[model samples]
Target chain A: MAVDMTQKPILVVKDLNVHYDTGKGPAKAVNDVSFSLRPGERLGLIGESGSGKTTMATALMRLTRAPGRIVSGSVELDGQDLLKLSDKDLREVRLRDIALMPQGAMSSLNPVMRLEEQMIDAIVAHVPNLKRPELDARVQQLLKQVGLEPEVARRYPHELSGGMKQRAAMAIATSLSPKVIVADEPTSALDVVVQRQVMQTLGRLQDGLGAAVVLIGHDMGLIAQFADTVGVMYAGKIVEIGPVRQMIEAPKHPYTKLLVESLPGIEVKQALVGIPGLPPPLVNLPTGCSFNPRCPFAFDRCRSETPQLQEVVPSQFAACHLYPDHKELPPLPARATRELHA
Target chain B: MSKEIVRYIATRFGQLLVVVFVAVSVNFIIPRLLPGDPVQTALARLQTSGGAANVDIQAVSAAYRARYGLDAPVWQQYINYWGDLLTLDLGVSFANFPEKVSTMIGNALPWSVTLLAVATLIAFSVGSLLGARLAWPTAGRGIKSLVPFLMVLTSIPFYLLAIILIYFFAVVLKWFPPAGGVDTTRIMRLDWATTYDILEHAFLPCMAIVLGNVGFWALGMRSQMVNVLGEDYITFAEAKGLHPRRIFVWYGMRNALLAQVTALALSLGSVVSGAVLVEVIFNYPGLGSLLYVAIRGQDYFVIQGVVLMLIVSLAVLLFIVDLLYPLLDPRIRR
Candidate 1:
């Protein structure tokens, strides 16, 4: 798991903010958040629904549409500020420099086109000079690299299985060997066995291209296995982030601790532990730490003050008031723990 | 074409045959269903028009009955009707005897078909493109301004539009002729001069059809394009870094066109019916005008021929649409 310290990060996101303009008010989907990834690094971001995991992934690629605007921040890819790039420049950087493996693999491919044509669409958009035969060969190679047969090149998306379609999309995402791949729940629509295989393919593709990946998903177990570093997102913020082993075993933030324990256990035969309350509404979040109402350890300071992410332990960062005062996250009170409905 | 497509086409062709059979049967039965005898009606009209008030009225009526094969049983006439239809013999027009119904319709068919073909092609293409652009987030102000204008055009009937076009382009402006299909004084020839003259007269009627219909197509296509633009594939296409124009046509319009094609199929009947009014207003040398003249003269045979031709053409159009759908959407190939 040791990455070379001398290797400068391939991607850096600094204080990024994205807001969705609603009739009620601007919903702060992605609050000030920052993370960096070295070449060949994989960062898994896990959160509950509407936790800004997807918004942050899309904003990093500068693909945020109207109603959802990248308020202010810089997504620097190899020291180039992507936000300030012209439309032409941004298009050039996309697919060639960074690619997005979309979440809805079931519907992501254009239904009218053949599998080969969709791949060619991505390849030729970036490398327009390739000859027809060369493009055909390239598509075949990309598809085969993802464990699909060469004959799959002629099939339409509707003709392929869900797993095969997902792998085909993966083939297109990694066609140009981009510097960064933002995979937003690429396996969300697939079953477990297929999910594992797809993730492995994604990892192998990353290894081959030496690209950094920001894997966004809800399955903590899957992310923990595939990603070297894991970050926990809460109400538009990353509450805690550390190496995968420590983030799961010795989380520094109370939210991360509850999240890890909440994972259902098979051997114990105990009722599932549930986080008591729902996520806060984005438009009208509480005054202090967004999780205060749900945080069992909430105190006066935790209520009145919003904590910024700080390194409480080596290489571990957390946004919690208990940090720097208490060396470790305090144990959860037994009385406050509640069992989820079976 | 693949085997699946070929099979699909065969199925659609069968449907077309059924529709044609039903339409032809109805056309035959309609003439027979009239309250009065068609022979008496024709004779009465002829006498009024001074076609022979003195030439032995009873003998003339009996001769007419024998010429029309009305002397035979009803079943025999039905059998002869089918036999004649097989040979493309639609019988002679009562208003212009000895000029066969088939021959008359043949001359007029091209005009109506040409007008419909040219107008629909132009209107569908231009309106679809404009509508697709209007649905795009980056569509300019110039295209947006056409919305109100297109809506108004769609609301106006085609015949009304024909009158207005005649007034402005034919009467006031004198840029083109007001009525008819071509110059009356010139000898019809297959040359540029004749082509230009014919175009000059056909221009107003064509515009009436095109203008009245373009708005329906544009609005239909715009709404479809809007829905398609919101699909995940569109967003994925943008994420793939495709040029906006490429995405607009290949991804956006290409998908939206499936619905537009369906809409076009549903609207063809109305388009043909609407063109009837436009053709009459312009006095154009098309089947519509011929049908109008035949109806006034109670020329049952010509009316039957024209109606049959129109219904058959509509069936063919529907068949083409049915065969085309699976090509655009593979999911329907099954």
Candidate 2:
């Protein structure tokens, strides 16, 4: 399942802003988020809980249901604006163009129904025109693709262990060979061993389908291992974006620097430095920068004026006022370097 | 495979035995503890006018007690009772001239099973389905608005409703018979039309039983459905791009039904016992009516024996249900 990374960009997003009408007022859950994913590109969207990383991924496929509306966003999948499509049109795009491996795979399956019936149900929903024999063959191939025994098709969800259920879930998610796969915390609830297997299977699926992968989680270590492009989100905004190496070695934003420093190192025992202050509640967000209350480098200007995401280096962007002086800021000090190498 | 089946059968039969033993002991012991000789009371009333009157109280009571073996020591009576229960040898009914308690059960058993089982199945299935619908978010505000009214209907008593239905349909409108099973005129020459006629007369009673049980099942199933609707797997099913209907029916209802089926199984026992009021209301010649007559006549053997039989049947049904729990919920198999 070795994919050619040289293929054209398959999914692109520009100035995506999503807001939820919570009756108290409209809270901006995702604001001015933008990124492009090339075919077979493994992009990791890493942030702490409530950072709107998942909201961004869900908005891609128009999976946002009720209250959480896509207020202002342009989600382009191969030049198709998903926002403008009708309900019927969105269904066609969901499984064929983009698929989702949602959070909580263990409890996500039907308990009474056999695993194969669930998979077959997914196939009929998207490709209703496929004959029964073709559908059967496709489902079997998918189970094998995810490294499951074909005999598991007859077993119910409760019969399988947590890891097996997750693998089976992934099998159904990718049954249609969707072009873009958004895996939202797919391995969060699994053990470390099973997590590796699930993630590895996800990587292989991305390669096999040549899909643009959006891996959403709070684990920076996992993103560092698999992602090609890393988007560091803070309080519903993508605060930093760049090639994985540049973001890891030469982080510009204070929050991204803290996130990278917080990763557990292999060598020396460096005290992990976590970002201070909680993310602003979506109901009544901070006036200027949402991260300003937590940003240690918050000057008078930072407190009063929100920072627009601007280019700080070649093909690298950061939403912080500290990068205003230097167009291409150098990497942080090696004490921070010990954060990754320790 | 045979070993598993054998183990299951033995376990079920063992549970049935325990339940039967406990129920019979309670039936026998509770009456004795309630004060006064039941045999003496029966004979005292029989020896004179229906009213409690003074007569040769000692001699008549002694003759009655000795005749029925009630003059034996309490421990010996208890042993005989247990032995008769074990042998399915229910003694003569004190109320009937020569009828055995077991004969009464053999006559009335079919009537009870048919009336109660059919009514309960109808109520549970329809009520659960309706509850599932009410729980659906897409059912809209107008349909959702009816849930409270339906719940109110469920709270009304079945006996009160049965009497009201009898007054209107039987007395006022004269659409059907007021009471009793099938037409007695055609009882000996039973056929399809006679069977259908019996069911027609039994409909109001069945409706009463169903009315009492439907509310609980609907409310329980609806609440469970609401909880299951929000689970991650249901959302995952939607994310897999499955149709809204398939996700609701296959993923939503199927999982929700696993929980509902266990509740339904337990309710079967309750329906059998609870059908007493409905049976009495209709005079359907079931065990309820027979028990009513036996109670009025102070027939100790018949009352105790019938109570024991009902308990044993309920125990057997419950045992089968417990064994079936793993079939509905695969998680329980482990």
lDDT winner: 1
Residue A157, candidate 2: how far off, in angstroms?
3.2
Looking at model 2, residue A91 earns an lDDT score of 74
Write one digit per residue (lDDT tens) for candidate 1, span B1-334. Answer: 7887788888888899899888877877776788778778767877787754554546656755765587677788878777888899887776676579899989999999898899899999999988998899998999899999999999999988999999999889999999999998989989999999999888889999999999999999999999998887887888899998889988999999999999999999999999999999999999999999888866767888888888999999988888789889988997
The CAPRI quality class of candidate 1 comes to medium
DockQ for every prediction shown = 0.76, 0.56
Q: Model 1: runs farther than 4 Å from truth?
A: B34-36, B41-75
All candidates: TM-score? 0.96, 0.88
TM-score of chain A of each: 0.98, 0.91
How good is chain A of candidate 2, measured by TM-score?
A: 0.91
Q: How close is candidate 2 to the true structure, as a TM-score?
A: 0.88
Model 2, residue B228: distance off in Å is: 0.9
Tens digits of lDDT, candidate 1, A224-243:
99998999999899989889
Candidate 1 pairs with clashing backbones: none
Q: Candidate 2 residues B1-334, lDDT tens each?
A: 5566667667777878888778878888887886787766566665554432434556545545554478688899899877766677787665464567888988898888788778888998888887888788788888678677678767877778789889998999988787887777775455888878887888888888887778777888788898998888877776777777777777777777877888877676667766877788888888888887777776767787777778877787778777777666666654
